[model samples]
Target: MLNSIGIPGLIIILVIILIIFGPSKLPKLGRSIGESLKNFKDSTKDVIIDEEDEKKEQKQ
Candidate 1:
């Protein structure tokens, strides 16, 4: 899917995003997205740890 967007298409998309979002809000928006992704990663990590603990308890 991503490969379908060549350099020109990518540039156009970025330009549109910049216009819609604006420069000032872009950093804040990027940070917000980064945080949400981090939260998702952390939650998945916790779930994996819980599963490991459960398996260990079962083995014991």
Candidate 2:
């Protein structure tokens, strides 16, 4: 859905977001997004590792 937005459309969207969030808030917003993504990755990694260990234990 988002890919349907061409280059110009993407640029327009970015501009709008910048206008709404402003430069000062942009850094904080980006940091929050990054941290959220990192947390999600770490949690998912833990779940995957736990599942693997469980499977290994079952085989043994």
- How many pairs of residues collide in each model? 0, 0
Candidate maximizing TM-score: 2
Per-model TM-score on C-alpha atoms:
0.81, 0.84
Candidate 1 weakest ten by summed lDDT: 8-17
Looking at model 2, report the run of 10 residues with the lowest lDDT sum: 2-11
Q: List the residue pairs that clash in candidate 1.
A: none
Against the reference, the lDDT scores of all candidates come to 0.97, 0.97
Q: On residues 1-60, what C-alpha lDDT tens digit does candidate 2 reach at each position? A: 978889999999889999999999999999999999999999999999999999999999
lDDT string, candidate 1, 1-60, tens digits: 999989999999989999999999999999999999999999999999999999999999
- Tell me the lDDT of candidate 1: 0.97
Identify the runs in model 1 with alpha carbons over 4 angstroms from their true place.
Answer: 3-6
